[model samples]
Target chain A: MEKFGTLTAIAAAYPKVNVDTDLIIRVERCAGTPREALGPWAFEMVRYRPDGSEDPGFVFNREPWREAKILVAGENFGTGSSREMAVWALARMGLRCVIAPSFGEIFFGNCLQNGLLAIRLPADEVRRLMALASAPASATFTVDLARQTINGTTRFEISPRPKRMLLEGLDELGLTLAMEPEIAAFQAMDRPRRPWIYL
Target chain B: MGRSLFEKLWDLHVIAELGDGMQLLHVDRHILNELSGSRAQLDNAKRSLKPRHPQLTLGVADHVVPTEPGRAGDKTPWAKNVMQIFRDESRRDGILLLDVNDPDQGIEHVIGPESGFTLPGTLLVCGDSHTCTNGALGALAWGIGSSEVCHVLATQTIVQPKPRSMRARFEGALPPGVTAKDLMLALIGKYGTTGALGHAVEYAGAAIRELEIEGRMTLCNLSIEFGAKIGMVAPDEKTYAYLKGRRHAPQGALWDQALAHWRTLPSDPDARFDREVALDCSGLVPQVTWGTSPEDVIGVDGRIPDLKPEALAYMGLSPGQPLAGTRIDRVFIGSCTNSRLSDLRAAAAIARGRRVAAHVEAWVVPGSMRVKREAEAEGLHEVFRAAGFQWREPGCSMCVGANGDLVGPGERCVSTSNRNFVGRQGPGARTHLASPATAAACAVAGEITDARTL
Candidate 1:
């Protein structure tokens, strides 16, 4: 996992609500593609046309935005499926942060696990960010994880553990395994209480 | 204040609290399917880590496996390879694999509870979102991502922030023809997709208690559709009766002890929830989606709302158009959400004396091999076949379409699956979410027609 710190980069604005994971990376893409190689296929449905040409109207296909490292989106972004490939595709596509009004619960967690910052703000704040990101000159935004702010002004809140995980690039599995004695103790106590589950 | 069922489940599973509201919760049961589990297991192996508790984990080849007859030897090259990988990985990790030819093989969510691997007060995790379906057994189950999947394999625990609790009380008896599927759709339709975001939802009240185990599973299955990762119904006599004598269920003295623990798994009378929602199932009718999202639903007799022009364009539907009477090209009566024997019987009842319309292709893919066997023994498959509905083997056919069972592009389909997202069935496929009976009626009528009217 990549450690998340302060990142200042070009941002793309897509203000569509309920853009599900299927739309982000289609099911067909997930079937064959390796995780790291899914960058080009992210948002393939809207990114291309029937002729296999890029959809110029799409935010990512246009100038400057094609290299965007951040996204300002509408409410309930990444709203369906528990597929982590959606997060991987976005991260591979070079997005470091996503500012939205809301997000799917699992998608949000997947983002934290992958070190992609998913920040939820008020709808109005997201709209403000989206407006700023719509233009090439104003699209460059800063996301500081240590300071818990975006663009050095708008504040965001994340639970402390995830915040720390992102800042330190901590492997959660390793962290949990470090407390092996606690886990073993819990299992020992729980085994007698529910003997059947031990199998 | 008394504790909610969610709180009790949390307290029981917590191995250690890692500060900032996160707790490392022990996973009592872990189920993996081919599509998601293969990657996790492979990644864990690459990292030189072994499964901490492989005995508690089970693997099934369902997501991308073919559901056609004689599919054991015939599958797409990709699916065959995926299944082989899943088999190899499960073997190497010392986990049990219910392979394509296993009699108990099915969608993980469906077979887990059916085999008694899912139990009350236990914590279950799967890579697929519909894992919440197992929560109907009073288990604390939710879907996890691939990374989290690898984490669980290595530690037998998942780090999670405790979610707030919400209780949805369905008071009153459901009217005839209005099934649990209808009740859930009505709830999602009333409260948008994110209604239960960040909350653990518990279904309670008269209607919930009255529902059978399968019906409760159907209700809890769509909790993710409403943006709730965890959804459950408190265990009762119905839950216990359904679990008793199942393959993995406890026997003898263990059964008595388990029953005592399960009895205490429900929320206390004075328990409090962070949020409360009440609905009257007495008025709920059959629901059908008119747009791309699951929440873009209306009763079969209701008209489509004038919002979401993009969804309207994609679905080729007009505002104010009644959901019923819309032409459908196909009807899919299966998925983890509604592929149990009861669901098959419901659809079979509607198709018993009626033939599928000539233009409509109808398929009934059972949730599990057990469900398929039971339905066939009950002659439901014969009824479906006589009615011109194809009766296929058990898998998640046409639901995600990863198995090559897809609705055609531009074709409108009424499905009993949980999701109605864009391109979920297939690219350019317009899907209307409905119950098995409603989908069966649509096939017979060649349009979206209410089962009650049929």
Candidate 2:
């Protein structure tokens, strides 16, 4: 996992709702590609045509927005599948953070583990960000985790463990193993208490 | 403050609270599929000099496994190599791998509980989203990422933040032509795809209790489509009976003890949920997705609604167009969601004396080899074959396009799969998520036809 602290970058607006994991990285693309190389295949159907040509009309296909590091999307983004590849594709595409009104439950968890930040804001506020991102006057936004704010205008909330993990580039295994003794103790007791589960 | 079944499962699995709402929850079972279960995660763990609890882990080659019988000689070289690597890695790591030819081989979600590795009141984790299907047995199961998979493998636990509680009560009796698949589709359509985000949902009330174990599994299988990671049905007599006699189920005295524990796994009468929702199934009709998303659904006889031009263009549907007579090029009857024996029986019943239309290509891929054998023993295979529907080996064929089987580009299909996302069946393949019975009807009609009208 990569450490994510604070950064400022251009943001792109993709206002499509119900953007699913399939759209992020289709199952067909999972077969032959290396994990880190999945970026080119991100949004394969929407970003590319059937003949394997890029759709220039898509948001990510044009201008300075093509190099966007932050994304403002519609509500219910990442609404299907628990494919961690979705986050990998986004990160591979140089996306560090996503701002939406809401997100699929598993996608939210997947983002934290992979060091891709998913920020949930009010729908109206998300609309504002989307507008600002598309406007030539201001195409960039900043997400500062240390201060828990986005663009220094809105304060966001994140749990402490995820926050620390992102700041330190720590993986869950490292954190969980640090307390091995406590885990061992709990297991020793749990085995007897829930003997049926062992079967 | 009464605790729901989800909370009870969570509280029992907690090893240490990491504060900030995150807790280290012990994984009682970890299921893995070929696509998500490469040697990379294990290698990462080995590099860190960490150990793994392989006894608690189970791996299956489903996502990329060929569903054609005697497929070893027929698989594409690439798929063969993938299988070889998975088998080698599982052997090296001592993880139980259900090979493609293994008698118990199947989709991870279907095989886990069928093999009795998924028990009630246990905390289960898998790398695939539909892991929630195991929750039908009263287990707290959800999907995790590769990193989380490695973390759980190395430590026998994964860190997770508790989700809010939700209860969806399905009241009233299901009318004829309506199945658990329809009820679930209706539920998803009623509550938009993201309606249950950030919650663990429990299915309760009259309709859910009346469903058979497999039917309940069908209901919980697509809970992910509704944006829920965990979907459960309280364990009851049906659940216990389904678990008993399974290969990994407890025996004799342990079984008795397990039943006692499972009996208490339901939500307390006074249990309160963060959100409560209800759906009446008395007059529910069969459902079929007309657009890309699962929630973009309507009744079998309903018309397509006015949707975004892009969505409409992608699905090749027009506003106000009747869904019933929509032409379909293929019909798929298998997935973790609707590939159980009951699903097979329903499809067989629909195709018993009818032949698949010449223009349509229909196939039936059972959930597990156990289901395949049972369906064959009951002569369901003969019915399908007689109807011109190909009977294939068990795997997630045509559901996720990783397998060679697919609906060609721009072709329309009626699939008994959980997702209907763009390119899910195949690139540019338009999919209508449906029940097996409805899919069979589509095969016979060479178009989207209601089973009720058959």
Candidate 3:
């Protein structure tokens, strides 16, 4: 069940950290709007306007991230309310992997449930990538998770389990079902031999 | 080989190790509330799994319960059915169920730790993100989704991958008006929103040592904001004494043994971390978030920063405006983050017969019936009601904005709730996050004001 996917694209620019749930997706949008509406509403607090138009100098909208597939952000990237819509918005925006220093608990759960990859690189290493990703052209870096290295020149390795989950796209449920036989066998053990309570 | 608390807890609960960083973990505590119950029931029907460890799990009617206990059914028709089913299922399984009328019933996370279910060196899980709040007791804890809730209910174990570790050292004393909420908000500002991604943050240092157990719980509650699984304050006498005499705590000789081991759970002087973040608590003022993000804060003496054109248009706040002078239409003081007695004391010290501004609507909700009872016993409720603030029952209330109590569209509020994200308080409602004292002063002045105002 373990699977891994390489970064198809890199979207990098640091926004002010601690982005919360409601700001990622409006309740109005979650009520009836098409799921894809999440992309347009992706950073509502940062992207919202009475008349929608691009703010050329905006960090996410500026330069390269116009079609970012992977988003690299600052620390505590998804802290705030427990709105699942935030994950929906980021996923809809085609952000498959978020390599950051940290993430909000609810947002992290939401992402894992939806099969998004949230990788934690050290702050120093993430800072290096952020610096490289922000540069106009030469600042570009690659996240070759398959190789277990992040950048071409200054490669970094990921720990085993996260790498496995990311590569295989297996969630906790999938991981558990893989052990059905063992669980059943444990359950089937005779009541008399280990009779702690009634079944 | 050395194992972190993660590896140790993971090893203790491992029912079967499926290769490659996954294992079936025996869930020690299965915490449930209104929102999780509905989704879990639906998923269970689809999956056809019976209850696994119902005795190990506990349910409370909070998320959808109204602040007024009698009108619980009217809170939401959706919640009515959900709460009914939660009651029915728990009764069916003989599980511990604390519905709205129960003494322990409150926001599931807040009551879990305070009422004695949460303990040291254990695993506690809840469907609410703030469940990480229990990690303050030195346990390994985190939040899960509804489907995960269903899975855990059907099978006490949840499968999870390990996360990296980060250590946050908080040094120094908090000046008189500062509370744990202010310290957490200050950490968010310095670290930005995404600063602690995928790392288990261990909070230690002078300020952390000085904090009361409940205050430390407040500190750990907002870890989700910084993108961490949980935050921990190493077990100390404060933690032991708080847990003592609670219904779930160990007794007599067992207590001596547990305390002896729990005392050693703190990190050694030489323990290394993938990352380290530190804060000096004294300099932080009563903090509040002016923008959507929790870290989007300015001190009580500060002004909201000028925003980019889009941010300016999204939130109606104009750039470069002084936060202290910005009028707030609503003021709320309650949530797991700031509904404890200390929070009320802070807010009431600022309110106390000071008429709330003509333009502001204020609410002071105690975290639990227990908290409300304690506050009322101490006359804190009088201080609140005297200020024209609505005194409400113990429930999540406006924290999740689940019930109808919410700020009107386009109206601005200074709230004691954790998040200030858009609509976090209500649809199209603008929110500014502040500590209880700040919220109280804002209500009195109809603008963001210092809690220490003369």
Candidate whose lDDT is highest: 1
lDDT of 1 by residue, A110-166 (tens): 999888999999999999989999988999998999999988889999888888889
Instruction: Show the colliding residue pairs in model 2.
Output: none
List residue ranges in candidate 3 displaced over 4 A: A1-19, A23-109, A115-171, A177-199, B1-24, B68-75, B307-309
lDDT, model 2, position A94: 94
Question: lDDT values of the candidates?
Answer: 0.91, 0.87, 0.73
Better of 1 and 3 by DockQ: 1
Mark the regions of model 2 whose C-alpha exceeds 4 Å error after superposition. Answer: B39-42, B45-51, B72-75
Task: State in Å the error of residue A18, model 1.
Answer: 1.1
Which stretch of 10 consecutive residues in model 2 chain B shows the poorest summed lDDT?
B42-51
Q: Score the docking of each candidate (DockQ).
A: 0.78, 0.74, 0.22
The number of the candidate with the highest TM-score is: 1
C-alpha DockQ for predicted model 3? 0.22
- Evaluated on CA atoms against the true complex, candidate 2 attains a DockQ of 0.74
- Looking at model 2, residue B267 earns an lDDT score of 89
lDDT of 3 by residue, A1-199 (tens): 2254556575566645555556577544543344457677877655644457766656668767766666778766676655465777788876776777766656766676666777677788777777767776744446577775665554555546656666777666656666667666654552232222121
